[model samples]
Target: MLLELKILFARQAEQQLLQTTRDFHSCKQEEGQLVSSYVLKMKGYIDNLERLGHPVTLGLVLGKIINELHAMLKLYEQTLPKNNAPALHVIRAVKVKKLNKHKKSQPQMAAMGQNHGKGKNREVYAPKPKIPPPPKREDPAKDSICHECGETEH
Candidate 1:
């Protein structure tokens, strides 16, 4: 009975470790999430796996972190030492540049209002030019002419 219980406990630990590993592998940093928080989240999964009796190497964790980070951070990855564990503090401290998301072609949606210092009120307004409507088309029946028979109607 003791041996059976031990096996069951070990199997449960192994299952937990597997689930933790899967979670860690599938973990991805969401948009606007800070690098520190992202690293900490990954560390949490690694810690849980370690506690479950499945040991993960520092190098493997480092690789996983680098792989999961934005491609823009690839330049920073090259700077890390090949063999040693990555410095989480330094990685978290480094600010990853976010892509400029604003479209240049988009028109400004709102104009700023101005306040006048004097008691007299003067409203400033920008007038938009009105677009002229397209010219009306002539009747197709009236305009139709067939040159082959020299006839006004087909």
Candidate 2:
């Protein structure tokens, strides 16, 4: 459960990092500097998380990092300039947006086996073909008998 939450958080962070990279690249030189720096910090965290094979530890670290960043964002809000963004503010905004998106994307229960274990060959579960209900029982009056032999089917 904790692991599921953590993986979701990490994925959201990854998406935000990508978004920040795009936004930073779009900004003017001075403005872009902060975005780039923020992107680097986030990329480091993301890369570490990606290399993990399990979710529990990665999720805990990411959750802690996320909370710390939230705190830092509030504490450093004023660090941003009126016309230019500060590195903290850019990263904080990206983190907030990414976490929100992460919440929305993840299912309530952790996916059964989204991560770990070498995948195996398996048969698909297509439903069996339907067979029509057995034909209605024959009635002597409604069913015809064989003309000569009088066999039931005939």
Candidate 3:
């Protein structure tokens, strides 16, 4: 009975995965469809545009795309996911990840040097770093050293 349920779940998961891929493809197409329709309409306007040659047509088409993108951004801003906090959080997280890819990070560690900063080497499969070590003495036998002879007085 347990095996049957497991098989059933596996089948369902496979089906859902196939359906998810299908839906994702369809969603991409839907977004494209909106953009393409705008592009086609822009094409139509360009075709009939008079007293203007290739450059004007290209500019007009590009301007139309920009307008479409601006409008889409506005719509997205206004109708962002609100309820179903988990789904909204997931969506926002994905958006943040996507946005982060375009951003620059702080100064890289490689600039520090090979095995940089005295034993601060690259971690292979370790967890987070620990606390800083305590300060050490500059010269342990400073008191025993003679100032005149530059030797240990003891």
Candidate 4:
């Protein structure tokens, strides 16, 4: 009876280990997924696999993380540590620092890079035309030409 129980327990443990391994291998970061959350989920699987007597190495976890990370996190791919928590912290720190720096200068950089000639900076009004006033109408009786001669009367 004791031997049978040990065998059954061992088989159940083996099956659990296999399932955990599958979960770890199949885990991947979704589009726009948070890196911290993804890393934490993987770590949870690793912990479970460890509990089932399956060893999960730091390097293996790191490789899985690198494979599953989004393209935006690629910059830190070569530099991240092999361990889990520290790697998550460093990635978050780098991303936050980069975002803050970018936010401060993004508008100015955009304005400098784009052509504003026909954009929002374009002039809205054209110059007005200069026109002369009409001359005052002359009084015919007060300042008129003489009928007999081609001369003006005082």
Which one wins on lDDT? 4
TM-score of 3: 0.32
lDDT value for candidate 2? 0.54
Candidate 4: deviation at residue 153, Å?
A: 43
lDDT of 3 by residue, 37-120 (tens): 755655544443331232344565576567767778777666766543455555656676666566654256556654343442
Model 2, 1-154: lDDT tens digits are 9999999998987776666545433422233346456546655555544544323356654564566456555655666564465445456556765665555443433376553333322222323558899777668644767778886554
Show where candidate 1 strays beyond 4 Å.
Answer: 72-154
Worst 10 residues of 1 by lDDT: 96-105
TM-score of 1: 0.44
**Sort by TM-score, top down from the best:** 4, 1, 3, 2
Provide the overall lDDT of each model, using Cα atoms, as 2-decimal numbers. Answer: 0.69, 0.54, 0.55, 0.72
C-alpha TM-score for every candidate: 0.44, 0.20, 0.32, 0.44
When 1 and 2 are scored with lDDT, the better candidate is 1
Better of 1 and 3 by lDDT: 1
Runs off by more than 4 Å, candidate 4 = 70-154
